[model samples]
Target: MPLALYLLAVAVFAMGTSEFMLAGLLPDIAAALDVSLGTAGLLTSAFAAGMVVGAPLMAALSRRWPARTCLLGFVLLFAGAHVVGALTASFAVLLITRITAALANAGFLAVALTVAATLVPTDRKGRAVAVLLSGTTVAMIAGVPAGAALGVLLGWRAPFWAIALLCLPAAVGVTKVVPNPAGDGPGQGRRPSLRSEFAQLTNPGLVLTMLVGALVNGASFATITYVAPVVISTAGMGELWVPIVLLLFGFGSFIGVAVAGRLSDRHPEAVIGVGGPLLLLGWVAMASVATEPAALVLSVFVQGALSFGVGSTLIARVLYQAAGAPTMGGSYATAALNIGAAGGPAIAAASLGAHAGALGPVWASSLLTAVAMVIALPSLRVIAPGAGEATR
Candidate 1:
């Protein structure tokens, strides 16, 4: 890999850290801001909601500028947002900062995937995008653990500060290494209205692929927020060991992503079909581990691996479905992933509040997998893989 590739990866790592670290620090933030944990969670909601709004908006406006500058600007916005998040005295001001940072966060990642595809040879595009996106896995498996530790040991403000620290180096790295052409990227000018971009999105196959992405992501995140609690409570583990088990889960998650990326390029639907069920089984197993600590750890491992691994296939599938209009498909996938992250938790929260146990998320996860399985069936009846370049 080129050294410059690492630069893009750095930006992703920083962005992923910014997105995931907040969950760990929510209580501290809530306490400091004189708000409830539920209220502090609005920070995550605000970020997701902002992505739904900001992704296409940024994609549209930034097309007139060079891709490098746009990415750098978004990083700067991300950094400044975190700075305000760390320093602001008032909850309202902090909320505003999060929204701003988060909007930039979504826009940055949306373009980053497209940019990554351009950075390398066409043959390596699959893995290249995977490597860049792998930062999310790293941030979740590694950054979150450290950030959460920092937040708990130092204070809630400490994690965002740590994020900003990481961001400074990453911002400089991306600026130094990522190429800045004098004009827009290849084929950029032809991009029509966001409506035109989305018009292609209505294709039955593409919509189904996106639904697979959304439902899987939503179920994963929704249940994930409570995984540690489930492990400790249901598995009857010592409280001190929660982080260790969570670390194991994270390790499985990132490794899954790396493997799935390579696999998706070969057999997209096969990858998802296998991955989705593994994840469903993982969830079911996780729910049933009320008496077996050993079983809980095993479930977490499988959960991390399969849930995120399937994502590579899911994303690649959407891009393929969009045919010639990849940018729109990419942006749509970004939005769908965000929606899933939000939707799954919302469902889990509402249901878990009722009489259900961990089974609530487990069954919900299973239902989603079933839906994705049905919807993600073969779309190319006449033309399959390696049938020559797709003409749509």
Candidate 2:
């Protein structure tokens, strides 16, 4: 991978840390801001909403700008938002900062996906993307915990300041490394018009590709959203084991993504076809053995590996299918993943509200993954017989 890809991943790490770290600081934020915990949780919802809406909106608005310029602006904007968030005393101001930060994060991710793909050869696009996305998995493993510790030591607002500081190096790196899309690169030449970009939305292959991505991601999140409950209540584990279980899941995900990156370019459809069924089975296993502590822990790791392995493959497929519309392709990919991230927890919460036990999230994951497979398997046969490379 290029140094530019690593620099992009550095930026992603800072943003991902800010995105997930808030979960640990919500209680502190609520107390400090004189708001209810439920109200403070709205900050998270606002960020998710911003990502879903901002991915495409920001991408389109910045479509004509140079890739380097867009990335630099987004990174600096993200840092500035965090700085403001750290200094704000009003809950409303802090909430707005989260939304602004999320918008910047979404735009950065969208453009980064396109830039990463273009930075590599057609065959290595999946690996390039995997390298880029590895930042998030790393964040889950390291950054979130560090942020939580920072919050505990220096107070909740401290992590926000740290995140803003982290972005400074990322901004400097982006400005120095990222190439202009219009320069002598794979993304060079005539840009697609807005009309042509919209036309790709009607591509059946691209639509199915994104749908599969969303459903798979939704299934992953449904289980992950309630992982603590499943580990504690369902499996009767001690509270101390929660972090251990989560760490296992994160480590597994990192391994899965790395492995999938190597295979995705060569066996994209075959990997997804096999991994999807296994992922559904993994969820079912979790639901069935919810009370078995050993089985439950193992299941979490296996499911994480399978979920990200398949999920990353599907996203690579989306990029390939929507390759003609470079600007909109990443937007569609970012929006689909964020949609899943938002919807999965809502469905899981509903399942719990209906008197389902701790296993409800596992069941929800199973159903969603099964649906993804049903849609994806047949579609792959029709659209991806030899579809490793971009189609148009």
Best by lDDT: 2
Best by TM-score: 2
lDDT for residue 323 in candidate 2, whole number 0-100? 80
User: Per-candidate TM vs. native?
Assistant: 0.91, 0.97
How well does candidate 2 score on lDDT at residue 13? 90
Candidate 2: where are CA atoms >4 Å away? Answer: 183-187, 387-392
List of clashing residue pairs for candidate 1: 218-340
Query: Which segments of model 1 are wrong by more than 4 Å?
Result: 181-195, 378-392
lDDT of 1 at 19: 79
Query: How many clashes in each structure?
Result: 1, 0
Which residue pairs in candidate 2 have backbone atoms (N, alpha carbon, C) closer than 3 angstroms, thus clashing?
A: none
